[model samples]
Target: MKAKWRIVFLKEFRETMRDKRSLGLLLLFTLMYPVMLGVILNQQIKRATKPEREGIELAVIGAAQAPNLMVQLKQKNISVEQKGPMDEDAITQLLRSRKVVAVLRISDKFAENYQAMRPARVELWFDSAADNGARQRDIEEVLHAYNSSIASARLLAHGVSPATVAPLQLQRYDTGTTAARSAGLIGSILGFLFFPAFICGLSAAVDSTAGERERRSLEVLMSQPARTWELVTGKWLAAGALAVIGITLELFLAHAILSWLPLEEIGMSWRVTTFDLVMVCLASVPLSLFASAVQIAVAMNAKSFKEAQSMLSFVVMLPMIPGIAVSMLELKTALWMYAVPMLSNQTLLREIAKGEAIGALPFVLTFFSAMLPALAAVAFATWRMKSERYVLAV
Candidate 1:
């Protein structure tokens, strides 16, 4: 019986390989997905490491009123562009152009107020719509420092202590690292990597089942000495074998790309070594089998190639739902997540990428989650194929 199934398996596999279109699709996805992911990640790293601002450009109106302040701004690496006094409309236009981070307008009574030892005013003009918050904050810091210096000098000249103005001192500490910040993004990226299992062998699965039936050859094949289970198992393995090859190659290519790139530039890390990746690929083998089993079971029920293709399109999207829902809910990982097939694989890979020492339970659960359902699907397909309705239709 094993020999019979092996013969059937080899026969189906040979026929699938003979179809150049199916071979091309399998090869394309195996290469395309990893390359595309690598390109996207590279772009993200570049953007994250790029400098926020080369220099904070500030527009100063009535610059002569506060030459000392202008000198202080320049000392802080702020570039100042002098302009005559302008109305609100002109200031708005200047900010919209993004040529300056902000406008510093010295009040007309600035010099008088300074000499009189009275309060002075300055209007800070900026466009809230622009992405200049960091540059604007830098400008504000320089202005505050200048004001504090002036206040201290004036207080000392008046025989008063400048320390009385500030009763409290505060310091800020940030505990978040780039790796921590990048974990969520990296998790999302890894979630999509396993999706090829559902796509790579779709054409082969549909063609072997519905295409065979539509071509009126299924009835003749069923008349052979092999039992229904043997025939179903052989076809299932053939399709699953293609999915396995495609997914395995894809994972290896993605591993190479990730390891070669400097993911640290964006606070992300790919700590998976070659041996770890090999283990992941081994654990993921059942996912392709499960995907193919489900596809063969569903597609065999369709009457034609186009019909099978259409129905399986919706079926292919089913695996992605769990991953998307988990992301939307922002749920933390738990033991139960490892029992959910596609989600389990995604979570396992994500945790592994984080360099966590998750013990063997996740690997066991991930393997069986797909394996159990795959066996059930193949059994169901075999039972369905033995029915009088399917036989009559064939």
Candidate 2:
């Protein structure tokens, strides 16, 4: 003989499985995040592996005035296009169009200014909001080098050492490793991978509770011999089971995509091994349960499916707030982070991705953080269902 909750679990699970629309939503959420992550990372890898200055195009308003500058730009593999003198408005439109990395406008007085040993006025125009900072910096470096060379020549001709005007020579050495630099980027991605847990279970959770109520079937179920806790537990488990499957598949797919990509080229890595991933999946199980439990508790209060969905839409996004806040503030990883459900899973995965051998405390904290909340939600839902007002309203 099966327990009442087990019977209810099987029944709700089968009904949820039978809804093609529910299954379709589950599949979509499960695949969408991993695919998005893969595509984004792939683009980064492509950009990183591309040759520097391979296809930089620069527009010069007066190319004839600075033949030496043009030669230097060409030598650096930058293709320079000559254009007639343009006003600031024209240059701004050109930059907005993004046809060139930047525009170098040489003043008509450049030749006279150079001959008279006055500072030449050259303007570098670009869209600061555009993603061409690196290319713009390259062009600026060439201009700086040309200026230095001419300065050195003038000093030599005047019987003065070029070093006389210089007091310090500076060089930079970066101590941060590739993995360290890429951690924030990878962490942001990992944070969203857990999003499917909330989405995949949402329809099923809402349908099994609020949908049933809207159809007036919930009253009949409530009147059954089964206790309120049993019914709530069964529904919670069914929704949670779907969430678990969705998140697990998403994580594995993400792992496959990240592992196959040449992340090393971009100073990023997915250092989680098979064993580490298995542990991560295990620790994340409670997060899915927590999502389902919270959804069930919240959805049961709504008078109809539409209302429940509108409310849970906001609820689903609530978990991401903490993670985003932490990222925005650039907070350091600490043990307390693992005590916050969604953030815990994100931090744990980030640590593992950085090849850290974190001990069992994070896993324990992650598990219990969500697990306890889940149990409390289930309890609250059961108590809510058993209330006189709830029964009368139904």
For each candidate, give its TM-score against the true structure. 0.82, 0.81
Candidate 1 overall lDDT versus native: 0.86
Q: Candidate 2 on 1-394: residue-level lDDT in tens?
A: 9999999999999998999976987798789888988898888777665437357889998888878889999999999999997988999999999898899999999999998989999998989998776778888899999999999999999999999999788899987666656666788768888988898888888988888877878889988899989999999999999989998999999989988988888776677788988999999999999999999999878767898999999999999998999999989998899999999999999888777678999999999999999999999999888876664555
- Residue-level lDDT for 321 in candidate 2: 92
* C-alpha RMSD (angstroms) for model 1: 3.7
**Candidate 2 global CA lDDT score:** 0.88
What is the TM-score (0 to 1) of candidate 2?
0.81
Q: Give the top-scoring candidate (lDDT).
A: 2
Off by over 4 Å in 1: 22-36, 52-58, 64-77, 84-105, 111-177
TM-score of 1: 0.82
Q: What pairs collide in candidate 1? A: none
RMSD value for candidate 2:
3.7
